[model samples]
Structure formats: C-alpha cells, structure tokens
Target: MPMLYLNTRHTLPMIGLRVQHNTVDTPITQPRYEQETQQARAGRGFTQPKITIDSYPSRHSYGYTNNTDFARENLERGMSEVQKGTSKHTQMAWALAEDGPKAGRQVGIEFAKRDMEQRVTRQRTLVAAAIPDPVIQVDPGQTHGAPIPAKTTPIWHTEGKAQITYHRGSFETYLQQKGDIHSWTSEGKYDIYA
Candidate 1:
C-alpha cells in the first residue's frame, strides 16, 4: 500500500440536499345570507340594517375562541327567532295561530316555558373549557411540584331578555306608547301588518 494511498474523499461526488413541499387543500366556504352578507350582520355591509349594535362590547382575552363561538351562537339564535316572524316560510305560524291554536293565553305560556328552557341551556353551556393539571403527584415527599391549580374559568352569562308590556288598553294606544320596537331608531321604527 506504500505511499499510493490517495485521498479518496476528494474523488467522491457531492450529493446536494433536497427539499419537499407538502400537499394541502384549503377549502373556504362563503357565508350564506338571504338578503345580506357577513359584513351586514357585522353592522356594515350592503344596506346596513338599522338594527345594528349601538355600541360594540369589549371582548375577553382569555376566553377568545370560546367567547367568539358563544357570540356567534347567540346571534344565530336571535336571528332565528327574528326570522320566525319575518321569513315567508314561517308566515304560516301567524295563520296557524289564528285557526289552529286555542286558548291564546295557554299557548303563550307554553311558548314562554320553551323560551326559558332554551335560555337556561345557553347560559349553562357558555363556559366550556377543561383545565389541565400541571403537576399531579401521589407522594408529597418533594415540594418541587406544584399541585394542579383548579382553574375557575370566568363565564359570560346572558340574562335572556325581551321587552314586553302587558296592557289593558287597545292596540293603537299600545303602539303609540311604545314608540320604538326592536330598538330601531326613531326614524327606522315602523308598524307591521296587523
């Protein structure tokens, strides 16, 4: 082998590094609205419904995702309730109320109970997060571990409210007394077909 030992490392070809790209599918679903867009519900899109929030409330930092979900759900429920009165499909409800349902007082009471049930469920499910234990030890021989702090998550509860006035007066007097219905502006308030 004498002095014929050449540097074999110098004869080897250099193999460069390689990079790869991963396949990804990003699907975006556009919002669906019968007569408006997301921005409209946000209070500033296409014809800006006058019944927008008079003031924007501050959002919680710790409960961002949760609160956002709650807000969306709350809004959806409210919109659904409103749609019951506005949507043409539900217009039959009014007609049905006329001929099908008897004892308007009892029917109203049942509706109130159902509304209460929904409200109760909504309130209870508002705060949904499980706190994980940082350190769980069987023996207390070493104080290097901090017992899991039982986290008390803050809850944003809704009072579930609706403005109602039971009057012994006529419908005309009632409407006149209640200048604004649905919290619309004075100029925006209007009467519905009786």
Candidate 2:
C-alpha cells in the first residue's frame, strides 16, 4: 500500500459569468421653441435638441421631472410683468406725493402692497417651475451590488435625485429688476438592470 500511493485534486466547473448593462437618459434642456426648430435640422436621425448658452445671466443645472405647461405659463406671466411693469415705482411715487401725502399715501400704500404681493407670487412661480439643464449618468455597480444571482430577470429602478437645479431668478430677489427670462431644462437619472 505504501509503495503504490496516488494523489488527486478535484475542481468544480464554472457554469457562466453574470453580466450587467446600464443606459442613461439625457436631461431635456432646450425650450420648446428650440426643440421644434431643431426638427428641421435633425432630418431623420437627429432627435436630440442642441442649445447654446446665451449671454444672458442664467443657471445651468438639472431639473426634476415637472409640468412644462406650468413652467411655461409662469414664464409668460413673468414676461408680461416685465413688459407691462409691476406698478411698484408708480405706487411708491404716489405714496410719497408732496402736496397730498396723507391721502395719496394711503392709496400708494395699498398699491405698493399689491405690487409686492404680485412680485412675490411671480417669483415663487418662476422658482417653483424653473428647471435648469442637468446631466445624469447611471452606474450599474452603484445601483446594484455585485454577485448578482445568475439567470435573474432584469430590474428597473429610478434613483432619487441628489439635487434639483433650475434656471430663472431667485425667490428672495424677485423684486429686483433683473428683467429677463431663461429657458427651463430638467433631467433625471434612472438605472435598468438585466
């Protein structure tokens, strides 16, 4: 027995290696006008709209999924206010009239209050709906842990945004006459695993 001894090592065969794929959806940044105008240039294959950053003071960032109509309406309101004016300066002038300061002051105060309210409302609307251009990428590894089970069905998920960025003026400084409106762009990132 000692003279005729044999050694053997056993190994298990590997079935298959698991693989994952990730796809990212780019954020929509261009306004509707641009989106439509690009159609002519797009021909057939070019679907994505391209926008250039204007010289106007605006923020470029990611915006969450939102109602474009709402944002557009508010934008129109803001534009209208800019065109027609908020009646703030006139109200102040009336309030400080020299001869009839007392009577004029009362009417001026009312108008001033109304103007302030309108400005605040306008600002909040813009801020609430302002969506800035944002870039989003999905990392499959981060989305799902390693060692995924073999022969599993694909999974779909949307990662909550870390931050929401939007264009337009600040809510705090709505009263200031910045006098311009910017396009709203919104974007979100999602991960699909298979």
Candidate 3:
C-alpha cells in the first residue's frame, strides 16, 4: 500500500482563495395601523378638552440559514489538483480527497451560520440605536358645557423592516408618524369632549 502524506501548509498559500458573502432579507410582517381607545376625565377643567398620548416602540428581528456550497466547491477544486498528482503533496492527498471536502464544507457551514448570527445581532443593536420611539401628539382644541366621557384611541402604525448588510455594510433608517381623531360631540360650555 502506498501511503500519501499531505502537507496543507504550502498548498493553501498557493491557492489564494477569496471568501464570498451574501445576504438576503425578507419582511416577516406587513405594515398596518391599529388603535386602542380609553376614557378619562378632562380634569375639573376650564374649557378645552385634553388628551393623553401613548405610543408603541418600533421592533426588529431576523432569521437565516447557512449554505456552504460555495466553500465546498472551492475547497474540493483546490484539493482535487493535489489528488491528481499535480502537487508535491499528492501522496497524502488520497485520504484528504476522501474526507477533506466533507469536513471543509461542514466547517464552512458552521462559520457562515455563526457569522450570520453575529451580523443579525449587530444589526439589531444598530437598529435599536437608530430608530426613535414613536411619538403621538393630540391637541384637545376646545370644549364646551360639561365634562363628558372622552373616547381616545391611541393609534399605532407598525411595519416590519428587513435590512440586508453585505460584507458588513450599513443600512438606512427613517421615522414614521401617524395622527387621527374620531367621534367627538359638543353640547354647551365644555369646549371639546370625546
């Protein structure tokens, strides 16, 4: 039996392979508006009706799977040359040619999976720092007669965002604002009542 002794220390340097990375993002949730209403007193008030505003915070999330086909192909191609007696390490290439591709592919997959996870975590941190909390503004305007039960609906316009970063790149962010008033009736002295 002829034993093959493969030395990777020199073969790898000669290959000079470059790593490639790609990212794809998909929105898991659709954008929509929701409202919740509550009743509160205008508070022993003078004239105008007052409103208390509450807003929901923006949210972010991500998911991914690692496919190392690219890494597998590159590694196999590079190692095959050695297996074909093209390199000094051909003697050792026999064993590696059998198991090297599988091991290399698994390593590549694990590395890519971990890398993607870290990227997602970092992106989430960046998004949290970038997006500001939602703001709700209400102008009670004027009221009349007596203080009536006011119906106030806190409105929130929420949407999912998918940010894809290629080779550790940056993403764009912006603020969204929404406002609305529903079902108000006026009788006498009190200015506004819901």
Most lDDT-accurate candidate:
3
Compute the lDDT of residue 170 as modeled in candidate 1.
26
Looking at model 2, report the run of 10 residues with the lowest lDDT sum.
34-43
Give the winner by TM-score: 1
Cand. 2 TM to true fold: 0.18
Every model's Cα RMSD, please?
A: 63.7, 54.5, 66.4
lDDT of 2 by residue, 8-117 (tens): 33334434433343434456443332111211232222233445444222232233224675588689989988766646555456556753455434665576678688
Q: Put down candidate 3 lDDT per residue, 1-194, tens digits, no spaces.
A: 44443322211212233444455555356556666766766655345556655433333212221246456766898799666545434534653566557744554445457658876888443443454454667676663556557686766666645655445445444333333334333344333322
Residue 25's lDDT within candidate 2 is: 49
| lDDT (tens digit, per residue) of candidate 1 on 1-194 | 22322221112333443434444444444444333222212222233223333211222324434666788978999999788757633544664576446644454455557668887888544665554323323432322333343334444443355444443422221222322223222223332321
- Candidate 1 colliding pairs: none
- Which wins on TM-score, candidate 1 or candidate 2? 1
Candidates ranked, most accurate by lDDT first: 3, 2, 1
